[model samples]
Target chain A: MHQKIGERFDGRVLDGGAPDGMQTFLVEPDLIVEVCRFLKEDPELRFDFLADVCGVDHYPEENRFEVVYHLYSIPFIMRARLKCRAGDPPKVPTVTGVWRTANWHERETYDMYGIQFDGHPDLRRIYMWEEFEGFPMRKDFPLKGYKDAYNPFGEDIDAGGRDD
Target chain B: MTDVTILTENKKPGGGSKEVLLNLGPQHPSTHGVLRLVLEMKGEIVSRIDPFIGYLHRGTEKLAEDFTYTQIFPLTDRLDYVCPPSNNLGYAMAVEKLLGIEAPIRAQYIRVMMAELARISGHLLITGALPMDLGAMTVLLYTMREREMVMDLLEMISGVRMHTSFCRVGGVREDLPEGFTERVAEFCKVFPQRIADYERLIAKNRVFLKRTKDVGVISPELAIDMGLSGPNLRASGVDWDIRRDSPYEIYDRLDFNVIVRDGGDCYGRWDCRMEEMRESTRIIEQCMRDMPEGPFQVDLPQVAFPVDKELLQRSMETQIHHFELSAYGFKVPKGEVYVAIEAPKGELGYYIISDGSEKPFRMKVRAPSFVNLQALLGGATNMNYLADVIAMLGSLDPVLAEVDK
Candidate 1:
């Protein structure tokens, strides 16, 4: 099923030797919406399900950040992933127009890693407030969240007990 | 920054310039963990909902990159604190996939048993707490009682009630303890009756039904499109279940039905999970009966610690393998694998990228709670009463630990 759809989009299979056994496919960001639409509408490739939307930062490397979409086909019992690299402002074409679930997932990707999903309707931060300064999940973001003295866990327990 | 002015204008003002932006958490209960929900509210009815997560972000992924394969096992436990064992299994399964090694039959059976038990506990947390969120405090005690038994069983097997890093790469860390079967049998024998008691206590209760029945209604197609999984998706009448459909571990060898209800409401979500607890008990019983006798771990001296006494005592080579496995974890071949399991909430998958190093290149967690939590905005909050928001949140039962991580 992936092969049939991959052919339609001219998607190239990643080197099988890639780490984690992820069968990476490079889909044109523009064609992503159409490809996804076809995948959902096509009978053989009814990937009517969107599993997850996540962004990975490959900093100091070739690709700055890659937005990955995990799709599952119930009828075919197959899974496929689509990826696109966003270098500067970290943007990927939103699939929310195709899958409503992408509304929050794409927002989460944007919230955590500062990736902008173009054409995402209501692209507000899903897991972060509007005032949050920077993306928390970026490799550059510090692990300690918001270095102010106020400890949320301090109300339930002491501040010093929890450790690194 | 370009869109800042547009956002500000659209931000519905709460009470004409006196709009108090109240930070509900980073410590609030409804936020689940340390999620800070910035509510621009006039009173009880919220004007706007801005959920701020990452308060509990421990950088486990970055830590995994620095640590060895074995060292990352314990870290997965913290992701979904409600179901640590499931996270442990998911991580172990991903690593094992990279190494192209399947655990022994007995080990697989034990892993299933542990995972099922964890599923029941996770459901109990949601089921019991949903009522608590609805002001039915008595149900919390009853559900906690059931959860206690599960914790005790976990302690018996893994030596910790929570965050039991019992699951290893090849198999579990320790064998099932003596009389573990009989104890499990005792629980199973009485479990069905307990489930009935719970059903009567809340399933048809007037207040419970009213708060949940039509509240948080998520359509099947919408749920699937939104990436919802586990009981939430099951409530919407989607017959997709990782355990039944995909069948990893020893799940295929057992007989159990995926509990599904078509209401797609908060009550339906609750019903699906309540039925799931019963089904999980059945799976545990089947596991006990079908468990085979064999080596617990795989025969990989490089990854798994060798048990041969002669090698440790007489041969230096055998001792070196054991020392290396413990001190400097084995390197998984350069491969990327996405392995998922039917967790209590949904399809929990671990995507591990290993470049033939002691540390992983990139590790991504397909957390169910994170995906399911999106229902708060679309299904529950936008269409229901303000109080229904709490009921729906509790019903969705997202462990913010998983979401924030």
Candidate 2:
């Protein structure tokens, strides 16, 4: 699987060694859409099912955030993970065109981590309301949530507990 | 974001069929929970349907960052309260994967039994509730009566009816309660007859037949394209069940059929869940017989409390170990893993990334209802009446708590 995708994308496909028995790969942000399209359309690697897409907020790291896609091949009964790292203004090209299931999953990733999906048709907040302030899933966000009309006091997160 | 305006030269204000925007809920009962759907209706048929969710959002993933792994189990129970044990099992398995440990064989058996029982209980509610929307409330009363039996068994083992919170990071809270197996065995035996009663009442009924048969057909390709799972995917003729294909825990050892239907209609989805109830019964019966006598929880003291009561009471070292483990939760290895189980609704998954700390770095739930809820959009609800839309939504069975989570 690695050699096949590697030959196509060359240096773009970086193997993210199998963790917990899951085969993971780190793809360049620019190539993710094309790569996902190939994985879905290709006969052998027919990863037709986009199981989930979620964001990971790696605050204090060089690449601050990551957009992770969990793909599954229904016919082959195989699973693979794709990760794309994003910087300060986290943005990754949308795979909505490749797999329609990416529509909601990408919307959710944007809503949670405030990571923008470039070219996503309906890129709007999912779980949170439109006017909600900060992304609650970010590492810097307080655990008690933002203070609004409903919640007067957010949370007293200690200075030491902010980072690891 | 395309808004199509009719430029017909009828020339009269408010003449011809005008598009009416109808808001179905954030409060309506038939929606099952707090879900608001904006329906663009032209005369009687819906032109488009947009589902506005998050009315029940509690930000469980955000809350999980501060809480320890042990503290996160209860939050999972709230996602799909109909089947709390399944949520518990998925979360427990994810945490165990991170910690690089497996629960005892006996505990795996216990988890499978509870999960299948949870499947049965959940199927009963939806199988009944779908018909209830069509003015068949008696089936709900009957199905709920059966659901209570499954709940009684869970309460017997875990001592809680809805949110048991019985699953620990490594394994279950305790062994099966006395007489619990006997009660479940009895339920497994009599439950098939109860299901037949429901099938007879609704399956051949003329009203039920007309309304559900080929009403909301989702093609196999579209079902996979939308990432549907469990009975929803199976009903679309996709023979995929995470328990069977992925073989999580001892499911590979268990013998049960993955119910599949080629009909791909509202009736097929309903009938698929009905057949699954029987499969779940078979699974529960198998777990009861094959379950071996062994430790319920893993022996690892870091993840679970010391198993021996005598050692816990007599030894100060053991007590101190317990205090430190509980008070300041033990650290897990730094890594990330996503573990999905074939839950009643679909694939209930927990993706956890640990920074080698007591609390997880990031925890994301790939909630089945959240993804499956998207199917209500597109042609599934479009061009259908308000009544048929409700039937379609009911067939999908999206739990709002999980959807908004």
> Each model's TM-score?
0.88, 0.95
Best by TM-score: 2
TM-score, candidate 2, first chain: 0.92
Q: Candidate 1: lDDT of A54?
A: 77
Q: Which tens-of-lDDT digit does each residue in B321-352 have in candidate 2?
A: 89999899889999999999999999888899
- Which residue runs does candidate 2 get wrong by more than 4 Å? A155-164, B1-14, B381-383
Provide per-model DockQ scores: 0.41, 0.82
Instruction: Output the worst ten-in-a-row residue range by lDDT, candidate 2 chain B.
Output: B1-10
In CAPRI terms, model 1 is classed as: acceptable
lDDT of 1 by residue, B1-405 (tens): 423343365456653444445565666566556666665644445566666666666667667777899988789998888888989989999899889999999999998999999999999888888888788888879989988999999999998999999888999887899999999999999878988998889888999988888887888888887788999999989988988887888888899998889988889889898889898999999999989888889888899886455778888877899888878889889867788888888989887767798888788888898888777655442343457677777888889888867
- TM-score for model 1? 0.88
Q: Please, what is the whole-model Cα lDDT of each candidate in the order they appear?
A: 0.79, 0.88
| Model 1 chain B poorest ten-residue lDDT run | B1-10
Measured with C-alpha atoms, the lDDT of residue A56 in candidate 2 is: 88
